[model samples]
Target: MDEQIITNELLKRYLQGKCTVAEQQLIADFLDDPNNLILLHQIMAEQTNSLWDSSADVPQHDRGQITVWQRRLHERMEEEQLIPSDKTKPNLRKRGIIPIRQRIQWYAAAILLFVGLGALLWLWIPQGAKPSEQLVHQKNRITPGSDRAILKLADGSTISLSDAAKGSIADQGGVKVQKTAEGEIVYAAVDKRASTQSYNSINTPNGGQYRVTLPDGSRAWLNAASSLTYPVEFEKKERRVKMTGEVYFEIAKITNENKERVPFFVETDKQVIQVLGTTFNVNAYADEPYDCTTLLEGSVRLVAAHSGKSELLKPGQQALVGNNMLLSEADIQQNLAWINGYFIFRREDLGGILRKIARWYDVTVECPPELSTMKFTGKVSRSQSLSAVTEMIASINKVKLEIKERRIIVKK
Candidate 1:
């Protein structure tokens, strides 16, 4: 394939999952060269088709080999000057194709411009320049929804939602919701729970998340590797739900049988929290070791499941429910930032940040000795480009972090 056919912009967009079908097809065609196609065939031959299709077997078999081949093909295409993709799509009527000579001239001028900039940077800039988003550094700390979750139900049938089909499997009350490809589940609660009907539960793995709604017009947003169990309907004076992971709740008030302040309650692995009317976030990732219940608007009380140790939290206060104790008056915003699509850190140490990153991004963190003590305080939008995050951390002196696709490695 000609390098001219594969534009840098197209490759970047293709990797980012933002390419249109047409643009995607162009990149796929470029990648699926005869040689590359033959390479996959060769890999298949090296292992049985069954093994290739399995998650546990494929990585152990040929994932690294596959990457090596892809890189080889990418390098070959770059060297051959294949297709050139449009970086910007201006109106077709406004911009016309330039002659080959003009393009070559433009490329040469661009090279000189970069060279001049580098010369100035070498003198004025410090010894180590921070990486740019354009560099695609291995040390970016952006997390994505990792496909890892185990669904646990009251009947004891565990369904792993991490890689399940993205569609409606069954009816829950009156809600006809679907599980999206990105793993953000959707449902509209349907009312049909009888008096004796049992409840069901879904658990996300350490690196998983999902969403659900109650039949009483309440919404639940689950965060990584958490589990939630609820009845098909409210069916009582007050509604109640049991959770293990983290969840953001939007409760719809229900009337009491005696009208004596009947309210909805959230019971976690450690605490029984009451919420009548309000929004709140609960984090009970077992792996996190420290469970949190944060109130955004309404008030909630966190009590020990075994000892009955209780603490009432204000709107901005958070309750940290640990295995042995409960502490109130924590930072509510920082604990619940995940629900709002932001990873906000305030002087959090490397180990502490790693726990949060591991849950949201579904990747393991390897922090070397020198960088383990380092702390960071900044706002990294969860929607940030992965490359931009990598560059941002590279801005801090002394510590270094590298992002190798999904896995992140910390360095001195």
Candidate 2:
């Protein structure tokens, strides 16, 4: 097992959303107990006194109020005789003003000051069991997806990018393809003099994701059940990539021999998007009703594949092409939530939400027709187990879920 040492600085970085995913996981692992209140208090002490001044940046309150609660908790710990006796004293380390056990008592007392449940907590604290904590200990829970994908080189050979050892994996047409410790494939073109460019494809299965840096320095993030095919070198007049399913791109700016910016084009089933230097997300799944493109930064032009109709999109705008082409203002964050490790449903139908879950969990869902149209609006962390997420939704919507092997049955 790896040793994890949490520091006040790391906690501060976590509070500021500046920590990496692994760092966030480390902090979460350490914070699973009230005994770890010492670390929590250390974090709080490093911040401003007022709650409003904390990392959340919400409403403000008087600093004296917290001091009053702290004092009240200290007094209650003494009255309840919950503090360990001197003879039975454990080798405890003090982080703040009180011993570790006494600090827990202070926290329980403070809860009483706000929640008015002093007696209930006083009885429960000695047992050291919390309802929320117990619920999390359930043994049956699906694990979230991690680094998993397949890389198809121009030579008709494939490599499992997720399992491949980090370092140079292959060389395609003078371009060095290397897998990094971060589970990303990077292309370093060694010889630009190659007369022809070789194409490579990367595909992600259900419950998988991968990132790639193209030869042009543009970065792409592939979501579950998606594939991207690109050339090993951008020797063409315009850099182009063909993709299926869903992907997010940060296109790089490149200039041609004419001294004009070369346009990057993304071809999907429903439409073609052209941009010079911008960030955007494209959802072109075969199972979905429409192929959608959402622009995040800069601008993009979307041309409908069937009708050849064109629509120019600004940041925070979306273009959807199906039997017809339509444009509307979009929620940029919601579109990019999957890549950022979350599912933000905004009044979406239950069936639509379940489709996303099925893809991520790699399970089949069977729901009654009546429940298909049920609407939901909430954000759930993608890292949560599928059962936990479904249970949460079931509780809120007054529904039940039956699990049979890998299948999920949704019922009223």
Candidate 3:
């Protein structure tokens, strides 16, 4: 069978369950050739675009059929091991002719091609039921988290950043604290010579996040379930801040009275990061096994609180503070994905991923012992609804995820 003859129309017919047996065999043969996978990808993209363009024209009753087709195709592909159930195995097929088992594996690839179309359709069509609906019909749907936090002033007053109007929220000692239109808290020194120096803290609860501009003009982004405490006005000699959970910092350069460079220090439970003028991220959640500091720009020195051990990190390096300080090349994108509105995983365990989901979505996760150690690699937007994110995880990892109230239960 000529691969060119397998046109979009033919694939659409196959998806509609109108393909002849010979046509099905032709698809299987086309998939057998690894080179044809590129063609399949192109066809899927084209089909997805076509469906999106004509989605409004699709009949209400037919939309349900589309959803069913997508679910079935996804299930069939998973059953055939086409999606690579075990991510650790390597593909051993050559470019030339293959054996019967290899050909059968290629048939799974064909199903995956269609499954991709179905998944895209499910995302585009609003009428299509969400993946969570298949598991259990719930009274309420869980939405995604957003920008929200609480600011604690030096006077023991609390301001809700989420509900506070966009203006000057408070005055801290000699500093003017204003909330910008973009929802960032900015601190400006109105009286640098004022005698009093007070402390203020910003805290993000579960399912919340916030950004702040400090007195020294440095900016920090706090991830969900994080907190940062700093002086309302930086002292003349050095700037220091204490933080928990995860936060990204871009330190501004400043000089003291004698023109000497002022240093900045970030304190976590496990370590203290000394910065001259640099951008870095600190993940120090107490629940996690280790505290990690990733440097994005400039240089920073990480000193362990207990062992007094220290490591200097360059722009692309990371220092992991645990039993011993381990320094390695960093995955900058993965480290900064939260601030950039993404959850990027690289062969991370399911339990670790769920912990992140729990913090961002403010939900409890019940992971069976057997599934906790399973590794997965994928990227999902932080803005997606809880059900959407879980659906992607469940579909790709071939697991069943049930949402009961605010809890996610993972099953084999």
TM per candidate comes to 0.56, 0.67, 0.71
Error of 1 at 277 (Å): 2.1
Off by over 4 Å in 3: 1-134, 193-196
Distance (Å) between predicted and true CA of 71, model 2?
A: 15
TM-score of 3: 0.71
Which structure is stronger by TM-score: 1 or 2?
2
In terms of lDDT, model 3 sits at 0.72
Q: After superposition, how far is residue 406 of candidate 2 from its true place, in Å?
A: 1.7
| Candidate 2: tens digits of C-alpha lDDT, residues 218-264 | 99999988999998887658888999989999998888878898999
lDDT of each: 0.56, 0.68, 0.72
When summed lDDT is taken over every stretch of 10 residues in candidate 2, the lowest stretch is: 117-126
Ranking by TM-score: 3, 2, 1
Residues 1-412 of candidate 1 have per-residue lDDT tens digits of: 1112112222233334443332222233324344333332233333333334555422342344334444564465557554234563233234332222222222222122121111110111122333333223654445466445555543566566656688875554454545676675555554554332557777776556677666567888877767788865555667788987678898876676676656788887777887877888888766666777778787777778867887767787777777666555666657777876766676676677777666666667777766655556545555444544444444443346666767667665
Say what the RMSD of model 1 is: 17.8
Model 1 misplaced regions, further than 4 Å: 1-143, 146-169, 172-197, 205-207, 235-238, 323-332, 385-387, 404-406
* Model 3 lDDT tens row, 247-362: 99999999988999899999999999999989999999998999999998999988998899988899999999977899999999888989888788776778999999999999
lDDT of 1: 0.56
